[model samples]
Target: MQKILITCEHGGREIPEKYGPYFQAHQPLLETHRGWDIGALELYKKLVAAGADASFFSETSRLLVELNRSLHHPNLFSDITRQTAEVEREAILEAHYHPYRKQVENAIQTFISQKHSVLHLSVHSFTPELNGEIRNADIGLLYDPQRNTEKEFCARWKQEFEKLDTGLKVRFNYPYRGTADGFTTHLRKLFPDEKYGGIELEVNQKFPQGDKKNWEKVQQIIMQSFYAAVK
Candidate 1:
């Protein structure tokens, strides 16, 4: 069955109205990569076009609340300023974070109820170099090793991605290890063992330049690789 679902949490950096001017004041910091996960949304769209049912967060900026990060993560917010007054922060979490999570949960439930095999592809992008250290891998397939389903998916993706472009480096569980926590945590717990499988696909930023053309290329690779893995 051609069943698939996709999502991208750090797709954008849209600041809420109350915090808009404040972020603008610190334009340099707010516009940096820290504010958004650069290029993730575009890749999600590609998956959608390739026949996957894709759900995405529409917040104006990730600076308000990082939809991808665990709600308890300390640095979810860039910094606390007057713009992030107590009331504003509460509202941001209530409106942005909760709704996005609800959407993901609902999608998972709907797919399972329909008796279709589900592949929850969480799309993400990472900077090639962090703290001045170069990241040599082109892609990272994150999956909890304890889960046989995730382990098999990750292994298959690694092989398929390399076949698409042998020069592109592909690794399993590098940069960050996959675990049943954060957004994927919710899905893993909600769905039954055999019906659902989740994979956090992390792409290095060197290829996708946050532009339309480059985004298209990244999207193509993801869709193709995902199709191959599922097969």
Candidate 2:
């Protein structure tokens, strides 16, 4: 069987030198949740070292493109005016988005050919509050209705995570709902016959930010839970 494959689309939030000034002016917003999920890449690396094969997109600019979002999504930019610059948008899409998606597709295909059962895990982080209400959960799992595998995986994951930390607040399908055309959606559709599983994990940023000790603690807990699930 093939080992599990992990991916983090919004791993880093870095503004390239060319876009540094723009980001600097809007630091409050750009550096916030709009840029990248803080520490997600660090957690992803830990997962990779724990024996899971991982892949991610690399870019030093948030204004460029979002690896997780579909290319056609208007949210690709911080503002719609960015679309006016056709050349820049095209360059960002070609250089970042396309390559990232292609890498994931290739990784899945490679493992399938080896006759391994593939588990797809996408890592992300969420803000404690959106609009005005505070989100009560510490973790959120998103899954699409078309793929029942996501539901099954979330249930198993929740059980494992809760065992690691009894006080941990975990929920199934909250914060963001999985869409049929999302990255996970595309991959599941392409590999319907494989023992394909999809999981979208959302960690509340406050936990890690408030307590450095808790950050590593949660990372270890997640790694252990994932290892158990795949093994």
Q: What TM-score goes with each of the models?
A: 0.88, 0.90
lDDT of 1 by residue, 95-123 (tens): 78888888878777777687776778888
Off by over 4 Å in 1: 81-83, 210-218
lDDT against the true structure, each candidate? 0.74, 0.74
Per-residue lDDT, model 1, residue 215, is: 57
Which digits, one per residue and each the tens of the lDDT, describe model 2 over residues 1-231? 755778888777666676565555666665677677876778888888888765664544455576666667766666722734788778767767788889888888888787876788888888888899899888888787666666777777888987888888888777777663468866777887346777777888897677889888988998898787665
Q: Pick the candidate with the highest TM-score.
A: 2
